[model samples]
Target: MGSERNEHPYGSLKDGDKISDKHKRELGRVRSSPTFRLGTLFTKSVEKPWRLLWLPFSILLLLVQVVKERVGATPRYSNSEPFTGESEQRNCVVFFPTNGVGLGHFTRLLSIARRMNKADPDMEVVFFTTSPTLHLLREEGFAAYHLPGRKEFSNMEASTWNSITEEMLSNVFAIHRPKAFLFDGSYPYRGMLNAIVRRDDILRIWVRRGTFKKNAPNVPIDSFDIFDYLIHPGDSVEPNIDEDETNNSIIHCDPVVLLDDEDIVASDVLKSRLGIPEDEIVAYIQLGAGNINDISSDISIILGVLHDAGVWAVMGESLLGSRIEISELPNVRILRDYPNSRYFSSFDFGVISGGYNSFHEAIMFSLPCICIPNSKTGMDDQFARAKVAEDAGFMLVEENVTRPRMKNLVSKIIDPENRQSMVESGNSLRKPNGASQIADHIARLIFRD
Candidate 1:
């Protein structure tokens, strides 16, 4: 199907023309015309000066269009009523996928938003998120509205969190005036869902990921009735979507990841940026932030094991000193950025969490990984994902990677035979990232495609 989409050349070639019948016909005879081709090339070469003269003007026009779009300059009625007749042109798909944890939800939403923009640049694909990592979106030239999110849930009460969530949504929606609101999370907080239910003009779309641990008692699926549609991003390559096949509101999609292999930072670039020597074998140890999983005590053990094995260790600053004090280890380096997965190619292998983003990136990048699922998370579905990775032989696991266990596993994992199998298994994944599917569906609704 992807090959067909590529061959068809309509969607893939956004903002550019594809091979038409005229082009095919021209190529047939043009191949025989060396002199005519030469003349045409000569004429085009002579016209370069004129083209150059107009280049600045072209750029200026494009810049004006972009600025106009960015400011929401078009005049429209602000009446508390739905658009009817010909004035119902949708300009944006406001996304609310921010989380207090890692950048998984934001990155996944970004992947889709970017795709949507590529398809229709006029459509203002905006982010109404609570993520403090707005700089990440800004760097990519995306407009995002900040929401006051509680980073730590240690002392937060349910009622308090609900109120905060509701107020955040209400404030953001009033400002952006979005035609559609895409909520990407396991449970849509009562406040946001209630807001969506009360609005007739707004199209509520739920972007939920599945393969949630069976033991994890989630909110009843009936609550999802408030959404007009549910985009369920599957966990496995060939996941059995039949279990919830009767849910008419759900549109199943492939697993979503921020970056594919091509987006990986070059090994040399990564090494230079991180100040690591070219020849050193690196293991990126990320057990996730303390809010997700508290593997503080085990960080020292993993680092010690890697150090003894003559391997360098790299970790996110959030992971270092989470559980306990981190000493000045010469071999351990801290990554201080969001979506650290982009630099995944720089490392030789990984010690990571079994969350969706981590698991997807490990396989997507073909990294030899030892995955540790967070058993304490009530809403997390890491164990199921870890089982998939284990069956594929792409991942090694431990309930709690103790000092002794890590030391033994290191030797077994780094063995040439097992490492080769792990790498091969990672490379065997055929599932797409499903970003385009999300973008396309929303684009159809937004642009009436």
Candidate 2:
């Protein structure tokens, strides 16, 4: 029967013989397969060793990966603080009121710096400014450095002027190794300016008094990079252009006015001393400290207009040198060297041109101003800032103004309804207590330790 024929391994019998010859051969092969059993046992034994090794190895790899990720994911903090130990030294310094220009920028910067110094005694603030501003700072009992500036006004070509200014900057930076430098204008001498800043490893800051959209047309915005930080002196007025139009480096701090509690007290005293009646409207006319020749004509026109409205003029320092005599006008008061703070509150209204001090102080006092922008005298920024103010309902009078136009504008501004509207608008726009905010920002920047 096929040798007891083996049903094929464990299956039922097939058709004819219950198991064919092929089935018999398969059963014999199975009975003889010790080699296959040995091979199966060998493969299983090999897999067991690999599995034992892989479990511990995979666990070790996972632990290493986790530790690596933990180390790699740590956050980075800025090491802005100067060295404190024997190996290194730490210093903080600021540059304000750059030489050979308007006192307004210098005065405003000085005011902010003074506030900062009062708050923190440890900081070192170096003022690299004109001799006149430095003298004023010295009188205030602040340490200041004076850079020798050219007093003569000769129009030199741009290339020649640039070289001269660069040399001047090199000399200034060599004397003062400041860690941080602050310049007032939007456009400064970039070649010399950047060289000094870069060489000293200083973090350069630019105090942009106002927006770039208004300044870009007149100032060289394309030539220089946007400042590391820009301090706008007014309430955050939206720029006229898209955000993409400006370089993204600027950090806009609050507009800074130098007036504080002492200044306010002094202003009150001056108001009382000047016999400026609290009830009557008093207008301060500040044409600025520089360039009386270009703005004098407009000043006469504005004065004539204010005189007609029965508004008193508290003329700024520029009036002292003006050829046009205001001595004849009984209502107008020539404010020669009055404490700036005291004179500020003496006015119910402010009719001034663009200067950092007058603009900010007027806002600080909540006084409505009819801004007559005077550009011919190196103040190209006045018109642009005036435009922003005008859009917000402040009155605007252009330079080289005529008597009739000035009179008409002043008459309208003095009108009860007009004056009320302007006052309300000014109050809405004024961020009265910004000095503390500015001080805090500066403190944090200077003292991160």
Candidate 3:
């Protein structure tokens, strides 16, 4: 009997004193308790509409906290003082080369101002430039303040910081007390920043174009502590010497290029003025802006090649009087104060003494150039630039121009195969519309509220 009872599957109940239905019912009730029901309800609540609303609210709260922390974390440097919100409406003046020495600097400055105006029309951009170049800027509908006197290379050395600073500051303060002042070129007038810094209300920026050449003698570093920023558009070309570092400085802005509708239109007009035939190939020859030393032999060599290829030559102001003998060449034309954009575009090729302005302009216009560097004027840099361009398959005249070399290079560029290759290379290397990128950087730095 014991063995049979053990074998039975329901053997655990034994004789359960009383097999009561009430005990079984109580066990079933225990499994359905309120605690388990409440747990299920809590999980369903997480998927309800109220949870969705709270989730977005929590995210918004997190974003607000992050932004507030970021704003607080920004560096509270002394340089930031001049760019405060209270000075937003104040005038911003830019002083650039106005004379016809090289329109490159002025054109680049103008392009920046135009971009600034487009970004914020309320901001004022005043130019304190030379008289001769004033007409060029005015023609483009820019409001500029023309400084008295002409640009004289003979007096360039004598135009010292002490003398020019007073004049520059006087002009700037007289018309409008600018909140920000910008200057172009390597040497900005000395004490100009000191005068601006005295006010404590102005920000001054220097737009430097040239890079220090390797192995060259060290140039004296100018003290620009009074200025808030020293913007190097092509700063990456070389590491700046420690002596050149400014105290209140912001570095690294894109290099400026002047490319606008007005510039294009003016260039087209210049092409017609220079008698450049629309269909024939044109070559622009510039022997440094207004610094031509000897041109008769140079022009003769250029004319010989142009005559052979039927290409027109557009010469700049420097070659004006030098072209007296070469004027007899039917294909040669002299353009004084011609718009650079038109002059650059009028040419399929350029024969230029290597200068930053002309080099960048040729690259900007995607024109092939035969660069003949003027070694006599400490322009050894042109040789390096020419070599780089030549390595990239663009035309280059070996340094120190000789009649035979000029003629040979000109002939090579005129050849359809060679010219086509140069054009393609230029198109590949061109960095167009850099001005807008520069402007955007400046606005962010100076006007970021």
lDDT of each: 0.67, 0.56, 0.57
Off by over 4 Å in 1: 1-89, 150-171, 220-222, 237-248, 319-326
Worst 10 residues of 1 by lDDT: 1-10
lDDT, model 1, position 163: 61
For candidate 3, the lDDT comes to 0.57
lDDT of 2: 0.56
Q: How close is every model to the real structure, measured as TM-score?
A: 0.73, 0.65, 0.68
lDDT digits (tens) for residues 1-449 of candidate 2: 00111122222233232224224433433533444434444566577866555555555654564454334332111112221211122254556565434565675677667776677665556676644545566776666655444444366565465446554554444344344667775446533442342232555666655544443444434323434555555533554434354553555555667665456654456556677666677787776664444665666777777877888777776422444355577777767663354556566677777655667666666667777765654434566666666777755546657877777677777777887787677665576555566566756654454
TM-score of 1: 0.73
Ranking by TM-score: 1, 3, 2
Q: In model 3, how large is the Cα lDDT of residue 204?
A: 65
Candidate 3 lDDT over 1-449, as tens digits, reads 00011121211222231123224323433433344434434555576857555665555654564454334332111221221212122435455543333455576677788777677665666787653556656665666765543244346543363456444554454345454677765444433433354345555676655554555443223345555776665421443446345465656554456665345554456667666667788778776754435655775777777777788787765422333444777888776654454556566788886666677667766778888766544312556555666777775767655767777787788887888888888665565466777677677766554
Instruction: Please give the distance, in angstroms, between residue 244's alpha carbon in candidate 3 and its true position after superposition.
Output: 7.3
Error of 3 at 61 (Å): 62
> Please, what's the RMSD in Å of model 3?
28.9
Tell me the deviation in Å of residue 48 in model 2. 68
Model 1 per-residue lDDT at 78: 19
Q: Candidate 1 on 272-334: residue-level lDDT in tens?
A: 877889998888877876675556677778888998998888886652234335557888887
